[model samples]
Target: MENLPYGALAALVGLSGGLVLGLAARLGDFCTLGALESSIYGGDHRRLRLWGIVLGTAIAGCYLAQAAGYIDLSQTLYQSVRWNPWASIVGGLVFGYGMALAGNCGFGALARFGGGDLRSLVVVVVMAVFSFITLNGPLAPLRITLFPQIGAESSQNYADLISGLTGLPPLAIALPVAVLCFAWALSYAPLRRSPRRLVWGLLAGLAVVWAFVGTAWLADQSFGEVAIEGPSFTAPLGRTLIYLMTSTAGGITFSVGSVIGVMAGAFIGSSIRGLFRWEACEDPRELGRQVTGAALMGIGGVVALGCSVGQGVSAFATLAYSGPVTLACIGAGAVLGLRHLIGGFQPG
Candidate 1:
């Protein structure tokens, strides 16, 4: 392990975590838009309830690990970056609406692409390209001008704030939150009956914890050469594409490994479930809509500094201020977009 490059080790950590997430998505039916769509229109709440299990487990696992000194939440971007409510609200809404139009978030697109959906491949590529465009390309200057991402003086998270206010340890405040999440999830009888879903939800949460812990250790060892990050599919997807195009110019990192791991894991899960069938978009109009949505997602994710999994799960795990607000806005925007599609923008 000492002989291997630090970047390679980071990639290994990302790959392991990403594989678990991919499996969770495929085998456990964990998804963002799918959950919203199912609960709102399909009259199913099991998947929505599954989110509670995932959030509860992730929150408990991450904060407990922090309390044990396994990782430092302060180093993660969610805490390190200054909190911007406007960015979270606006970016999340745009990203969520785009997700509704595209039929998936960046992470979901990768998972579906892994299942041999050629249409998803298009989404993945377009999203990656546009993410880079917004991140450092033509749109970067305007984005930065609008929502500057300066560093925070202290950790910007709910746990830290509440800890300071109550004079209690962060873990003390986080535990009950975790318990509430678990209780909410278990309250749903259908979710309780599905052992497979419960197990996978737990594993998915652990995967986020693993990323933080692993990368934190690596960052310490590497003297900050490697960033302390978790599973985020926006810029990471662009990084993977860049590495594929210019391996000589850039080295493999956690982002690259995670992006590839998702596809591989999705393929494996699809194969196991006999769901790996080649699919393509036959409608040019549908393809155009997906492309436009992907572009919006890329731009919005850049502004928000995360996709659904990034802000929804990873940031929430740390109890960051932006997490819940951003997620709520994303949900609202998704609901709006879904209604627009379902109603064809007609007055009810």
Candidate 2:
């Protein structure tokens, strides 16, 4: 008896996700662009390092939850065996480059948007539209023709691939590697000094992790047969766009719900904190950054299948091997964009 209101389950996952997102967005002031801004301009490492902690905490928490029978990790979208490494890795690299170009990762894009950065709205739209086109829009056929992936019979995990590469058990590699990453990020002295920001960072990161685990659990319960979906910005942005255009055909996804919730949460938090700035861009340069960044995010997200927070951090924390690969590639691309790609876009 396949009697399940998966739709409601999807909404529940979204609600829980929004609860956590609202709390995190308000408390932490978390954003990849903000982190980069701090690193580049303020010489502060607190935010960036906290991002690492957030991911680590979430990964640890999600895994523990799964081990404790609180959730089934296998039910999520990422767990299904699908072949598309080029789409993931190469696309991740492009996405990362876009982040550099866009000046914010996925989470940062949304966070910035909520904080009254109207430019971020442009970025979000480009990201959503591009993702839709690639996922199932005009370019869908091109994806089918060009990037035909072949995954192992029932898995798309890079952990298995890592084992083959290094001849170590997947867990053995994943654990030590993740731990090392945590240590490396926290090792930065400036980041260690800002205990307050660090705490907020930890809270935000845990929220990101919790959002996914909580959703997976709800998804499982909703269908009475584990259904897996995680919190991501890309699909939700697309969903938000789609719902606007095709209201009757497809309903909003959990991802979109999380995004909307985050916005509301951020807005609420902003109002309480007196941080709301309902202003638009007067600076053309800023506008350019927003638009360019948004387009890059759109195109890059399509290739990679998610944004920095979506696939890289959130997805990777699930111990999905491709998640890490996407993260690395995205980072690499961002570096390149920052290094060589800024001058071309003139103020418009």
Candidate 3:
């Protein structure tokens, strides 16, 4: 902390969090799409409960960190961005539908690619490329015009909003919600049966907290451009892609470290699990669908301001207004896409 460069410290923080996330994906089989799919079609509550555990843990961990004065929610992007209900719904729908079409979100694609899935490489590349396009390229203007984001006036986040309305401490509202979520998730018999899933879900949530706390600490002490953030796999993907091409141009940061760490962790996990094998798309049509899906996810994520992991876990951790709403919309959109695919494009 005292001697290490800020960039190096940020990367180390990212790698630490990413390793936990990758292990969760590989060993725990924790995935947003998988959780949604099982709940919607397979009559399984375990995966969904697993997500609840993650979200609940994240919420508790974040608020606890705030309570301890470790991190500030006001500094985070989710809080900084003005509440945009319509944008969240629309962007989440687009991103979710695209995720279903591609068969994976950006984070999932990276994990797959790490596990020797060649098709996911294409998805990752296309998604990153288009994310950059929307982030700072041609689509930037349209996104800004359609969804102009402004800062909140009185509150930093929804918890603050509620706290102000009810005249209670923000943690007074956050802690109970987190506790109820954890209780509900643990009450599920099937999820209770899976201790490994529970542990990994906890680890996943803690990973986000780790990143937030570490970076916030660094920003507090160091004199650098340290934006308080957590794990997000959208614009970071684009940034990572660019960094790969020009090493000297973009220095090491949390996003770059996180991207590589997840891949490395996934690779290690895949090897340990004896699941390392190269796989590619067999049909061109499938490839086309995946590409289109990747593009939509890139654009949609920028518009929405985060991806599944970004908004789902990180934003939810902060109790941001957009988190739950966007998550629900994404789930709804995925259900619609999945239904269309399963029903052979028949009207619902």
lDDT of model 1 at position 199: 97
lDDT measured at residue 148 in model 1 versus the true structure, 0 to 100: 97
Residue 272 Cα positional deviation in candidate 2, in Å, after optimal superposition: 4.1
Best by TM-score: 1
Write model 3 residue lDDT over 1-348, tens digit each, in one string.
668778778889999899989988887788888888888889997988888889889999999999999998878899877879988899899999888888899989988988999999998899999999998899889888999988777565778888888999888899898888899899999999999899999999999999999899888877537778899888899988888888754687889989888888888878889999999899887888789888888988888889999998899899988899888888887788788778775221
Q: If ranked by lDDT, best first, what sequence of candidates would result?
A: 1, 3, 2
Enumerate clash totals for all models, in the order shown: 0, 6, 0
Alpha-carbon RMSD of each model: 1.9, 3.7, 2.0
Candidate 3 error regions (>4 Å): 1-3, 345-348
- Ranked candidates (TM-score, high to low): 1, 3, 2
Against the unseen true structure, what C-alpha lDDT does each candidate score? 0.91, 0.67, 0.87
TM-score of 1: 0.98
Instruction: Give one digit per residue, the lDDT tens place, for model 1 in 45-104.
Output: 989999999999999999999999999999999999999999999999999988888889
TM-score of each: 0.98, 0.83, 0.96
Candidate 3 lowest-lDDT run of ten: 339-348
> Which model scores highest in lDDT?
1
Off by over 4 Å in 1: 345-348
What stretches of model 2 exceed 4 Å from their correct place? 1-5, 22-26, 40-42, 149-155, 158-178, 224-226, 244-246, 283-289, 341-348
